[model samples]
Target: MQGLQQFFTNISQFFEFLVVYYSIILGFCALISVLVLGIIMFLRKTVLADRVFAKAASWGLLILCLFCGKLKLIFETKAGWYTLGRWDLLCAHRIVSIIYIVGIFIFAAYFIYRRRRLHKFVKGLDKATTCSFDNEIRKYPGTISPFCIGCIHPIIVIPEKLDVQNALIVIKHEETHIKLGHLWIIAGYDMVRCLLWPNVFLHIAAKYIKRDLEDVCDAVTMQMNGIDPFDYGESLLANAKEIMLSRKNMKCEEGFLFAWDDNYKVLNKRIHRILERNGYDRKVVLAGGILFIMALIASIFGIKCFSYKRNNPLDISGIYSMTKMDTVVQDTEEKIVTGYDGDYIYIDGAALKEAYPDAEIEEQPLFVFVGGYYKIPGVGGGGGWGEFSASDVKDGVFRIENHDDIDVWNWMIMWL
Candidate 1:
């Protein structure tokens, strides 16, 4: 049950990261689009181009603003970046985030498959000595053990020539890896790193996960045996002489455990790390995790802070008119206003005036945001839809910026 709970928690945290990361990605793309549109508009001098650039600019800037706000909230060290232990999952965007997460799982599967295949092929050729573990075990070409193969079922082929004393210690060490399931854990961490590519947090997470796995395995191996850890490590070095590709047994050792090259550096480091296992600070880990989560939460609220609020679709309901230019014109009446192109909404301005007789008839241009909200420039009232002119509108696509009617907002078209 505890394991199940942890699994769910991890999935939740991973999803949150994906959501925020995707938002960042989208925000970046929107920003670039806006900048490009802006440049195109400036160069073209067309009203349509200008309008498109303006809309794109507004969206891009809003996204960037939100990103900045979230960054502060999530990573604010001054406030002790804690949000009730909720791992900072960017609870902002929904659809894009789901897409990002699905992509991660696909990439991880591919990466694991490739790495596992390489490790398996390499392992088959990694023979430590002439003697085989069993009659079925073949003597291969290399002088290193191929114990670091699969995350699920790693087969560490030790040479059968070692004394029982040495053999027992080696078995205990390998047993630690199998029992703890460290390889699987490492493989998972590697996937996370690959998915998030340049993220510093993922890098830190990978480091700790790797280091802890090794340290824990070392402790487990020592606890299982009475042999001195140093002696077991020495035996590993004594019986092993680094050998590159052995021409004599090359074909026979194709799938055996052997060293790919004559480099004994990796084995040397393992021995050193085992000997120098004196420190593992829990506080550092706790602090790191806390910071990671805090940063994620800050990003969500920060986005909200930067977002521009527009009127809900429920507020305004009338035939709104939209027009592009004087040359191409069409109003909601079959109401071709003349010369305006693109699209327009024609609201019942006459009816609006009848509802509020004293209300001033004014022309307001409309702007629409991503979340179905519309903004009317220079309008200051609670419940009045004024007469809006195509000339007054700055953009080609005009929406009746004050309304909550979904039916009215459903019509979507391109101006060109």
Candidate 2:
């Protein structure tokens, strides 16, 4: 039982490390995405550039999750723990860890419920023969807009009241989504978003990815079918109207829909991109790519730069026979016995003095030496404090160098 307990404890610690690692990476990615988007807007908004930015954000997050373990080790070894101490970093880590674990279960339950609901909804629809794509077409009764459902085996779902021509247009649009495996991307983003629920920036980035995916699908569908951009826009508007008419009955969930009626800005952007003659510019693409690479490099270096090493105080809780080094300032030489008893260090033999009860020994890096302040007991048991330094512990011997007024035979202490 004890061994099993230790095993679980180690597992929990690893997961905590992962939570911290991912949070840092995702937060940095979010800031980068925002800055890139801002620059793109200043230059000019192209569907291609928007798509590239969205892809970068999504794929960057996925890459971070994959390399979380290696990154955690790098952070601990190079960055150090003290660098993160100013922000109550450990408390934030614990909070994020708890939320991450709980969010997984919540999202899992929600996904199962959504799947069951989709199955039940599909059963109530009448299967129709489709001439365009080889997907299963179903007529849905709800006010939800036409959307392609399922990742592996997708189904094109259309509202029952739509005309034959409009239905075909919606079918073509959804089929484009499946052809490009957009559903899989959506699934990946959803999982990452849930896991990093504390990161609002990642959430915004996910929204951008979903929007750009729809725009890309719209552009491809019109170009492939040789359909007039204006006519296609009209079809989207008709679907949006239907969705809005029954908006009160809609249960908003995490899934891909062809038309989101509530988002006028996104709808306008899609229509504008569809109607534009020239698509993505080559120069803009090159610029966006450069910006993305720069951001990635900056994020990596920023993490490394902000980390600092934390020193663990030495555990000097045992007795030792002490001797003071005869320095140029110290004339007397005598052998004294000293011991550290948890909270205080004691000097026994001639010229007895006790440490101020709160003396701390800080171990320097490379195990070179330990140093701290020690107060000597005065008349009526008062405190007279002074700084002290000791050489590295070698062969169970500690050499105290700067003992101030106290002098001993030799300045080396051996563990008793």
Candidate 3:
């Protein structure tokens, strides 16, 4: 019990760090992502480029934003055009961390429960005695339209109400989704949706991704099977209009990649794109896309900088400035002693002497750098989301203005 309690304690503590770190950094990355997509969409229309390029860009940015927390390491302290304001109070209490952690677990648990329920339903399904395909094909009695589920031994569940002709079409579509690995993409996107459900920009991206995935599925399905685009579009319209679609499919959790949903808008747009497929050269679109993304990344990431001043405890009673931006206690492997217990960082005397050999360590005022929140009990701890680690023990404090802009770079030009 004690060991279990300690493990949970460690998890809670790490989550506390993550709550601040992820929210701030993700906020910045998401902002840039939305901007990047907007530009790419505009260009797509202007250049007569395929939706695939926009689709790829959306996927790239989605992944980049999720992993961009470590991107701060590569960037130097360069001032930009805008400053992020603080909502440090929202990131204030441990309860917030608990809520964040709980939300994730709830989604995860619910998914697990959903999948088990679905798997059980599939298992209890009468195993096909004489199926035409390698995958198990089962007819389910419900308004929920035909859909695919499972990962290892995949199952395609069709509604019993569908006539033989429409059933084949729907089956072919689901099969295309599986063969082209749309499920894998959907699986990944669903996880992201679960993790960042609170992020509105991500939801915007989600709508695009879902639309694109279907777009890709439709285009590829037609090409591979040589199906008439007109026929496919007509069939798709019929599927979208079917009253058999219901909320039951959502609970099925559309496990893996996707399930047939009653998203009328998605279906309508999909039909339009299908019938109007412009056979653009893939290589040209992809090559141009690469250049566009590189430029977009460079441009969108220009997080503007702003000047900020906060009380510094390390500023004994002398000229203090030029704090090394990288000497953060948590970030750096080097640590002397005496750290911040609250929202401020207390400078250690011995470390101070090491930085300024001439200074009388004992005579220096109690060094307390007040900028970010650090909750180290005995040792000093400090750093907002973008922790302002001050070593004014050397020069002006390199401040990344607002704590929310974790990747924003700052360097002090003068000292007080």
Candidate 4:
């Protein structure tokens, strides 16, 4: 148990060091997850998926919020046992929570405002070329999804004729986004992730997690539609032809959203697997659960081990007072030979002379000279080394221990 505890202690220390140096990257990873999930939710329209995503999101948000609140409190408060010590840990945590909550709210409000404006600016893009409901053929943009052209929420342009088909696949795909509330989450994620872009692991993790979310959504879509595997592939190819290669079709002005990018790569793989009759893998879910549990355990241990602790009175006095002294100037020194009976306070003769130049040295003992320095071990009546008697400081004279065996004071000096 001791060995394992030491090993874990080492690991926790290393992890804490990493956090201090790479906090921004960690933040980004969490933020990216939020964004991707939000995008998925908005595109799809289902409350159930949204609720699940929201719950996970809430936990992440809670953590970040707690951390932020702590930062603020730490900066605002004085550095001491009252602020940085274990007693203040909860207060610090509360501060972080406040910061995260405020930040998230501000970001959400801004995103909603922007989304609304965007919708008003461009709402006709999804309309098919024809207006008749019976024969409308809603065509997807070639290679890429629709792009926002105006400041308002940009409309997704689709041919009117394409609307004739139920568009179960597209609806499923988009519905996943809405139900998942991917947009809001992703927006929060991106904001945080951008601040920590240097961590490659975080970047990779963010990308992978987002892709996995998309895959999960795709699997659900296939399960719901029950379309022939071949037809789904055919639909993909058919829609691929309609997408324009122009930059205008890209989801982002500078980047492609639904092109043959990472998103599509995962999408393609998911579609193929679905067609092959591969159901959702329970192992993957199990593995994820196990990892989560391990992280939780590790986190709990780290908190317990690293969390602040109340300092004992004796230890606190010594530790806190050490900072106030500028120098240790010895006032006096006396050279005397003493029998090694484990009851003595051996003061350096030279150091004592240096501390007290005018002090007189009185000694009476079985003294012995060794290594050019006299040894005088002393044991007080009952008080310890730093302890003083009822008399004031001036009356208390420094005294060496009495040589005696079988005494408690004698045993204490032996250890010293």
After TM-score superposition, what is the CA distance of residue 253 in candidate 1 from its true location, in Å? Answer: 8.6
User: What TM-score fits each model?
Assistant: 0.40, 0.54, 0.56, 0.40
lDDT per model vs. reference: 0.43, 0.51, 0.51, 0.39
How big is the positional error of residue 78 in model 4, measured in Å on the Cα after superposition? Answer: 29
lDDT of 2 by residue, 1-416 (tens): 99899778866654554455444444434333444445534333454364533443435434333222223332344342343222224336567545555776686678668776876676667886656646888876555688777887788777777888888888999998899778888877777666544546556656666666777677667767777888888998887776765654554441233336347876776677677734455476569767876887776666444422121222222222223121112112222224332233333222222321112232321111112221100001111222233332222323333232211211111000
Better of 3 and 4 by TM-score: 3
Comparison by lDDT, 2 against 4, better one: 2
How many clashes in candidate 4? 82
Evaluate model 3: give its TM-score.
0.56
CA RMSD (A), model 2: 13.0
| Candidate 2 structure, TM-score to reference | 0.54
Count of backbone collisions within predicted model 3: 15
**TM-score: model 1 vs. ground truth:** 0.40
